[model samples]
Target chain A: MDYFFIIDFVQSLADGLLFGTTYALIGIGFTLIFGVMRKLNLAYGAAALAGTYVGLGLFLTFNAPPFVVFLASAIGAGLIGLVVYYCCFRFTPEAHPMASLLASVGMLLFLEEMMTHVSHGMPHPYPSVLSGATLELGDIWIRGDLLFVFGICVVAMALLFWLLYRTPLGLATRAVSQQPRAAQLCGIDSARVNALTFVIAGVLGGTAGAMTAAAVGILSPIIATGLTVKGLIVVVIGGLGSIPGAIIGGLLVGAAENIFLLLRGVTERDIYVMLLLFLFLTLRPGGLFGSAATRD
Target chain B: MKLKSLITAGMISASALALSSAAFAADKTVRIVGFGASSGVVGIFGQNSGAAMSAAFEKINAEGGITLADGSKAMIETEYYDDRCNAEEGISVLRRIASTDALVAIGPTCSNVAEPLFGILQAKVDDAGDTGLQFPVFTDVAIKGGLAGISEWVFRNTPSEAKMYDDLFAWIRETYPDAKTIYGGVEEDFAHSRFTWYSVMKTAAEAHGFELVGEAQWLLNDTNFSNQARGMRRAEPDVVAISAHPFTSCGMLREMARQKIQPKVLVGLTSSSSLETLSGCANEAQGIIIPTSFAPVNDEAKAAAEAVAAKGGALDLHSAAAWENAMILRDVINAAGIEGTPDTLEADRRKIRDGLAALTTAHGLLGENKRMPDGEAVKPYVFVHAQGNAWEVVHNPGS
Candidate 1:
């Protein structure tokens, strides 16, 4: 009996860790977009679903290798991001953050609708990028997919950090994000920075979408809202503009929810997660990370 | 003066003919309405079912419709209503049709949406107290067995899950006696999943001498599967069963993968034999076996599935049923030979219904045979195992 609970606790912990990878990835997508624009992207998760649809479409069409399908899906979703930027943000009054936020939500719905129309609400089977092999580490069974996903998330976040902090484009983007008028005065076209930010963020969203679908091996429109909510929760809990915070929050939430469910039933799983979010909202809205997003 | 009278007579005769035809047209038209989930991901089933029904009608028209005892034939005229798979919307749509002249109605695809809506419909169909609406409803895809609440007028053409699972567990006991513990989870919110996991599975497992180590529920829109996956892992059953629609099922499987929880055998719901399952967890779902009515292994079935895909529709067990049902319905119409005009519409409808109920077995375009009784059919689903990224027929039910 004692051994059973031990197995139960450890199993739940491992399961939570695996899901944390996906949560972290989704959080990163939201954080990447929000960090530069100072605008919350409701469509970030939708963009991911759109990408999974694209990837599946390509896979069905060509029966090509999985890598090719994943790449195509990523590119397709990136294109959708360009459309979001052009239609929702580019034409909007630059100073109106509310317009940008609402526009992203509209774009989310539009993309979700397009996916529904194309597939007629049938889920597309996504092929995983990594082989779903397992390694039995004594009492611990490590899923190769989860490990790969976590690795990918870590690598993606690191690369993004490097791009944002080390590159000239990153410097320009930072300057624009901090002070758009001042950046413009310095001959840095804020429009270009914003456009690039949208495209890059879209790429991240697409990758997250493709990877998670591939990990699970399916995609559907309903996931749009879940991903959006999880992503937002991670962003908020991690401190809006903090990349590391988003990653940390994603993993934290993922583990916490699983642990909660193991102790309680599934009905109360979300309640605990929401409470955790509430705790953050009430106590430290700035999150564990110092750099928080706040509208002027 | 005679010439003027003759011309006047001709003009009056033409007008009289046109007016008489218009007046009698409404009575002659036998209107039937179909409601379905036409908006979301699962909407493809409804869409294809509509197409198949139309095709069936076309074939009937071509071969001369239901022939009455009087040698008269009347064609089936159908109007489709998009329910969007919402119970509220389905209720409104059903109500709209209930008030109209639509004699017999079919569908509101989602079983989750079907429960309460069917209740509202039951009152209409089964009010012996003369208080409820009077309409005969035969749902196509709603698989709940408790549908006969109000009256026997509510019929279903769906294969009973209870019977299907019973046979399956019996077969499993006979085949794999050594496989002991069964651990699995289902989408709790969906009625299909809930009943499948709790009722049908528990009953079947107990009867078949297998013990259920654990059962868990994952919500439909849930993206993470840590708790459920962990439960399955903790149970450490020899076999792990998943009773979920494609999306959430795959999500749980990925979580299983993340936790590195692998059982000797993996089992899945019949509905999981779709493009969604293959795409979502292709690698993780490998070797996970399921029984399904439709497989594109046969030439004709393969061609039909491809044709649907070409038309941007994914053909699975459900869609395959649409195709097979269409062919059978067409055959019934051709066999009945009901002859023309509005007066014989009731006779034609009754004939179609009877013809469908009487069919014991139908030759399917696919290799599997569909066994029918009182309108519903049990599909001959083979034991299909997930290999890499696709469901391959591991055991041919043809045996």
Candidate 2:
């Protein structure tokens, strides 16, 4: 019995770690936007989901291939990101940062309501490239779809890292993110850079949304708010504006959720997760990778 | 002189035609208002119910409407409001409806909302002390059992889940004699799911000689079910009963499949027998049985299904009741001699409530449905299994 219990515990951890990849992707989007603009995009998850809806519409209307669906989702989310930037972040005086935050919150509600209306709040079957595939390692099994999500997320993150480090555009973005006044004095277009950053984050968010939908094998408007909350939690846990922190935070949260659920039943599981969040907020506000000087 | 006479005759004829058309346009209408959660996860139910009501009213109107007390024709006109499945919103909407010319109202689709909405209705029929709203409400979708007993003014067209599950387990015992052990799963966050799983499914299974092996719980919006699946696997029960909506049910089922926990018999909640379940996880949900009141079994049911489909809504168990409720409204109005005028709004509501209470049996799409004294219905049901992206009726308890 003890051996079986241990095996179940291990399996739960494995399952959550794999599923956490989607969260990592979402967290990366939030972190990137915050990293560049020094402002939070509360509508990030909704915008991403809207992009997924666009992909779903095409898939339903034209029987589009999975590859095309992913591409459409990314492009759709990127476009929505630009709109979100203009509506929520761009016009607000940088003096009152709360205005942009409030505007993004409003955008979140609007997107959620709009999507619910369009979909009639019905859950749709998201097409999966690898449906119900599994990998077995003696008493433990890994979900095939989640493994695929992890792979895609890893590649996306690698590409993002490469872009931020190697390219000239990347250099301009880093300079703007680190010191906007300095970059502007050096003739860098801060506004254009910020817009590009949003576009990039939106693209990443779209991919994350699609991955999440595919991993769960279902999509519904109800998921928008929950995803937003989860993404926010990940960002907070991972260290605000820290990409690596988001990844680690996502995995930790995912694994911790499953482990707690197993140890304590479902009713009490979330309480523990919330307690963990509170602990982090109180004890380690700077997060695992963030510096104390970077505190918001 | 002939041309002048002809033109005079044409003008006189046109004036008469216009007068007749104006009189026809002035025909009185009986207003029935519907309010439910029309913009949330369960919005489909409200949208579908509203569409079914509209289709039903359209058909009634096309058949020359209903007969009023004075032998005048009165068309049924409906307006659907969005309560968003909130208790406060439902109460406010009901209050607004009471002030209107609406003879009757239908739903606040969620039970939590319906509970509070019913509380605000007049407790006793003619209690002068109670200032509760004196209105009649015919519920279609809020399927939590015994909600109608809250107020005499409230009536439910929704099915009696208690009786359905009792019958379902009794039938399961006879058919699957080898299913001796049962495992339970529920959406803990939802009142209906939790109550049905613990009070109904567990009791019925145990009563039918099935030993309780284990149980698990989850939330409606929970995405991962690995831990729950592991628990279900450990028990290895012969039957796995899950009381959850389509979303969580599909998620749990898929997780169960991944963990390779194959139970011999799978029983699902009443709400899980929906298109969402099929669309979300048909392959995983294959062979899982659920008892439901609505199926495209007979000609009337098929027509109701088509009518609702024509209105861009699928008539499932809950929405099908809306179609029946519309027909009931017409019959009650005719039998109770309702005038359906603005001056008689309060009297009309009282008459409708009396008519609903007087019903012993009502005509349903399938057949006659028994109307209990407490405003609940003993609806006809069939056991269906998920098969190839569709629910195929396995056993018709009615037949």
Candidate 3:
């Protein structure tokens, strides 16, 4: 193989892996919610972006700092998550799985339309904390914002792991996911736990949104729907309710997407992705870390 | 009994007068309906187009409107619908408009929507073989070349991108004699971006003695351009031409900055010559040149720009074309001696279509636009470059 090919391959992989931090962040939100509730929140991406839009609004309205913007994004998305929970999942019976799913789909459209109306479908420039910073590692270059995103993802995931394993709320959430009746019998409020789970996932989603916008250096309503789809794909490939699986799946997807794009082109990149999804679904329905018991 | 009879007679006379006035008003109003994507990724374009149309119509109405077939003063009435940039929605809107008392229609902003929507129109005029919708569509936006030739019933006011890019590259070759190598990029998912990049931009650049060094592609919604920027950096081209809408174009430009890939010259798609690009990435987009059909260079253009801005819209090439389209429709209504009434709606529509088709040249915001044989317009254009968050004209070929 030519030296240029090796260099190109390594660069593409590095690019994809770094960009995959966004996918990982979004996937974590999906996995966390699904792990606790055993249900999909289709409006997750929209809610997250809605929070980002709130952050953008704050920036535009008050000239808020990047840290404040990101914090506002998380808090705002957490609030919207509660709203989504109440509207889409709270009233619906647990027995009717499709009801909550359909309601979330409706919520997705509602959020997208609402944002579109508010912004007039205009792309807003996002304030990046690390703007135009890059590190040159020999011939391959790494973007400063994306590296910041990667760092944020790692710190967020570490905190998430600690929260899930080392807290009373975590025990209650695990109990609820494992057995709702037992958790309820043990004096745990399953409804409260479910709502809290959504808030947590929403907070993560908000962080993901802020990071994504900051990395891209622009925010628009266009990314909401596509983010939702990518998040779902990551969730499925990462083994549904498995957080580790989500991370791995996100990185794998990112790397594979870039490599495919480099090799074939954009036209067939998505096809390869879908085929990979099919392979996982057909051969290992439980995904990398998902037990068969988690399958619905 | 005599007093009651007198009062009854008075009421009858008053009713007769009111009825006659209402009928006369109805006869002297021409209604046109337009549909476009008012709620999607590119929804802003449609909104701007709609606003410009409203502003133009308002101005026409304020200035005594159009003269009718019987020398009566008739005002123009317009209605706009949101197609959401969807082909099915566009077709549905067109069908609904066809059933209305509207004498003509406008828009279907996206080329993807316009292509299939135009296919539904009657292919040939008065053809006994083709059973398509017999309505007039005056497009203001969908700028993919050769769309006007799809049907006899459809006409476009959009500029020819092919000609624009050809002139642009020629100018670039003359202006920057040392710029020889060109790198290209496109949003592959969009019809306009893909066609302009592959067919117009590449052909023009090569024809002007520029060698193709590398090319990259991305989706309209894609936010990342790292790999593409790396490739561009490797190619080390003198010129980088990107065919994309404002969103992806800004994204790519920002990525290029991050990669430290500074090409000597930058050429952009015709559609990116707008305020959106500036608002999105003014710093990144600086020095990128694009050819556009409209600029507020003259008094009339300035007034129209202000009018559009008053209506909360920017006067870009697309929206300016929409404003010009409204004026052209007015002239067509007058020249065709249209009878603005429900009874003559179909015949009036046919007359408007014929009038539009028969035109050789029409007044544009910048200058006179030649109406081509295939129902397209050859609009006058100028080259503008992004500088300090604003597009300043660099060259006026006409001048």
Candidate 4:
């Protein structure tokens, strides 16, 4: 191989891995929504970009200290996620799956348009949370904020595990997701549990958006759209409606994207990731960990 | 003064009569139609540019319509069309403007659009024996210099990025000889940014002793810049030249900051001088140096730009060129005495065409034109270093 090719290949993987951290966060958001709501937050990516805008707007206005800006972004996107649930999912036809997808897509456009309108259809600069505070470890260098973001994602998912398995609210939420009519007949108030589950998913998405903004430092409508696609890819590869599967899928998507870029190049990089998704969908329809246990 | 006015009047009418005396001799009203991009993403730039031209035309009319070849005068009339900044749409708009009884055209913001429009203008105005379509035109801002060879029928009032960057690098070398070893990526999808990034900037850097370190090409719609950033870090260049628009550049710079990679000397092109840069990159965006044609902070240019802004227009160095362009067009028209009647569109366009091509220098919105030997006007540009959260004018290389 040419020296240039070798160097480019290695660098491409490193770059893909670092970039995949953000995608992992986005995947987590999609997984949380699917696990709890049985719906896709088409606006999930837009929520992230919108959260970035929220964080950026506040930062611009208050010139607030760093962590406060991150909090603002998280809370901002989380609140928007709740709104998307309210507007797009809450009163939807029970039989129509496409209704939720279409509504989420509409929310996606609305949020994107709102962002463009506020920022003059231009990209807004986002201040990084821990930009200059990274540590270099061995052959591979780890970015501090990305490290923090990945750590936070792990923690969030772990806490989500605790809530689903251990907490009473989590018990009710699971019962509602499993058998809504049966849970209602059992007097569980499935709608309330479902709404709360969406709020929780929204919070995770909002946090993901905040971390993504800090990691990337620029937010555009394009981010919202890309995140949605990546989230779907991760969800499909990981197995839809499976939390653990979403996690595995997230990491796999991240590492797979990196390795793919390594073998091929930037242009062909996404092709493999996409191909992997298609392959998984065809060969292993239930995905790596999907089971009849997840069946409604 | 009297001889100048008399000559201006005489030239105007003679040119008007030469176009088609039978058509204009019957009508007192003269139409001066305008064509340009009025909607879409860059709609404002196109709309404002045409409006700037019309503003000048309005003042000319208030003083008295353009004097004909005889002592008589003809009134000013206008028509405006929206090109939507689309290539095919631009061609259709030109066809539409040609159909209207309007003389000459202005606006349509980009070179890709303008390049095709130039071909159309050339075939109809210059190459086709002045039949079917023959209207004089003035280019406001389409930064690519490819059109210089399009036709003698076409002319630009703006400096090409090649000349601008060449001068910029020359000044940087003269001022900071220590700067060397450059690495960066250009926005490949955009013709203007790509051509400047790969061709003009690299050539200029090579000539100035700056080593070509590395390169990555990003598309216009690219949001995530992980792959590109890592490439730049691996390159470890002394200077990073990112030639892209705000959305993409901000994303790239943000990733660079997040990765904690720092380069000693960072330089951006003139086009990057915008409020959007800060809005996109924030704190991580600091320390980057960009050469800009105008800063609202630049007293004279600012005052003039502010005046335009006050009249419902925003002024950046890029947009500020419209004022300079309009004033230059006026000087050319006044000197050449372009006939403005609808029928004289052909003859008047030729005068306008010759006037623009003949202009060595005219007063600009900035300082003196200071025409170079190569016929390019060296507009004033300054190096503004992004300090803290704002851009501070660090060097006035122009002076």
Model 2, runs deviating above 4 Å = A294-296, B1-26
**Using TM-score as the measure, which candidate wins?**
3
Q: Candidate 3 at residue B113, lDDT?
A: 93
What tens digits encode model 1's per-residue C-alpha lDDT throughout A1-296? 58766766776687677667677777876776676676777887898778777778888887877778777777777777777888877888867888988998898888888888887776666676554577676776666666776677677677778888999998998888777778889999888888888777776777777777766667778878888888888887888777788888888887887788878878788889999899998999888784734433
Candidate 1 Cα misplacement greater than 4 A, ranges: A1-22, A55-73, A94-98, A125-130, A133-137, A290-296, B1-29, B67-72, B99-101, B122-133, B150-153, B222-239, B251-267, B273-399
Q: What docking class should model 1 receive?
A: acceptable
Candidate 4 chain B, which ten residues in sequence have the lowest lDDT sum? B369-378
Q: Per-residue lDDT tens digits of candidate 4, residues A197-225? A: 66666667666676666666665655666
Rate residue B75 of model 3 by lDDT: 83
Query: What is the C-alpha local distance difference test score of each model?
Result: 0.71, 0.88, 0.90, 0.69
Of the two candidates 3 and 4, the one with more favorable DockQ, higher being better, is 3
Model 4's i-RMS, to one decimal, reads: 3.3
| Residue B391 in model 3: lDDT | 92
Error of 2 at B218 (Å): 1.2
Tens-digit lDDT string for candidate 1 (B1-399): 999999999999999998886564423334555778767767766786666555545555566554434544445577668887788888888889877656567776777677777666434323466554445556666665555443434555565577766777777777787888888688887777777777876687677878888888778887667557766776788778788888788788777876678887777887787766776667768888777667787788777766666655656666565556555655665686544345555565556555655667776755435544444555566778888767788776457
For model 3, the superposed segments whose C-alpha errors exceed 4 Å read: A294-296, B1-23
lDDT of 3 by residue, A9-104 (tens): 998898889878788878988888888787899999999999999999999899999999998998899999999999999999989999999999
lDDT of 3 by residue, B314-360 (tens): 89999999999999999998899987778888898899999999999
Q: What is the TM-score of chain A alone in each candidate?
A: 0.92, 0.97, 0.97, 0.89
> All candidates' TM-scores?
0.81, 0.94, 0.96, 0.78
Candidates, DockQ: 0.42, 0.62, 0.71, 0.30
Tell me the docking grade of candidate 2.
medium
